[model samples]
Target: MNELLKVNYDSDRITLSARELHEFLGVKTKYKDWFPRMCEYGFSENVDYRLVAQKRATNNPKNPYTEFNDHEITLDMAKEIAMIQRSEKGKQIRQYFLELERKWNSPEAVMNRALEYSRKQVQALLQTNEKLELENKIKDQQLNELKPKADYYDQILQSKSLVLISQIAKDYGYGAPTMNKKLHELGVQYKQGGQWLLYSKYQNKGYTHSRTINITRSDGRSDVRMQTEWTQKGRLFLYELLRKNGILPIIEQN
Candidate 1:
């Protein structure tokens, strides 16, 4: 029922003039300078205040016909002004302004903002879901291309056996270096002595097989060297590991 509370308090288009505001709250400060300083303190025009041209007082001899700018402030801006005034009247009006604000910003206004935010969040989630579906379609298409060959290997993978590096590459349609790179990524490091050995954690894990081969050097010296192969379990393990990571092996046909 207060004079300040009686304005065109439209839900989304609420505003009040500076003169009307000062008169209602009994603010006697020279507001011409004060309002600009208040705006400088992070209050934005149109968002917090709007400057409008009003005709000067008819009694003014020199400026009666001229237009002067008056600020039409939002409730939020009025509250800010009340907070900055260093007087008991300021404190009283601040409390009164708070009550007015509660009436204006309570239930319905708060719900409108909340609903708008929820709508945006839902739209974002829909966009993200669409992107994921597109990626899944591409991945499914790639997997379909490999399905015919992958079916045969799926059978061979069930047998208990050890295969040489060359055989592994041949079966998986990859180079020896690429096979080794994948093994390394799976935490299977080549030993320091230039022999392919599983790391200590994978030792005796039935992931590897080895053999010794004798070769004569250029100096007519023959040395026995060890060669490592992948076990059936190891092959199956690598296959699944590579497949799950989006790496598809080219299937070799008989």
Candidate 2:
């Protein structure tokens, strides 16, 4: 067998035997037909005979093989071969041959190295996915815990009691104007009589209801009566009343 036909069992460098190299280069002719042409063209006597023969056989017959084999392989030829072998479309073909060569002739260390690299990449991707899943679960749990309190606050704001609105705001830590702004958004209405009265449209159809609240002073001598009616200014006043009394709940807004 030719020296070029012998495989190196230790080298990691990609290599090809003379016959194999010829096949890779796509030479259609036989080695016997090509070796003499290389010699006639001044290929070195020391040149790998099989490689030279394959090259000669593959040369276009129209352009007879006159180029010297003794000439060093140019950088352009090396680049051309690399481009063809390493292209995206050629990845599978190159990897298949490379793995086969590694399995057959390379050391066990090389195979182990490749396997270790692949394992590390898989482990990293799994860890990242797990962390994202854990964060999403925590966010969902937090939302579940706060939803009921928020709903309760909404119900209170939508109720038809000025006293209750003020109490809720004070309990929940909302300022008067802020609480009133929220009430207005919910379409609740307020009216001023002796004091402020808040009402909901659904509770008092046709805006006619006599939901009255009376405030008695601490001296036990002064009494105040407030009647409910629907108006924007009344609602604002009711908000002020609730805020001044410190009755807004902090839970409703958040």
lDDT of 2 at 201: 41
- For all candidates in order, the CA lDDT equals 0.73, 0.48
Residue 11, candidate 1: C-alpha displacement in angstroms: 49
User: What stretches of model 2 exceed 4 Å from their correct place?
Assistant: 1-102, 105-114, 137-163, 172-187, 195-249, 252-254
Q: Candidates' TM-scores?
A: 0.38, 0.34
lDDT (tens digit, per residue) of candidate 1 on 172-253: 6878887787778867666557687888887787878788889788899988888887888877776767777766555633
Cα lDDT tens digits, model 2, 49-145, are 2233233443677876544332222222222332354555244334445455546555776777677778888999899989999988999888876
> Worst lDDT window (10 residues) for model 1?
4-13
Report the alpha-carbon TM-score of model 2 versus the true structure. Answer: 0.34
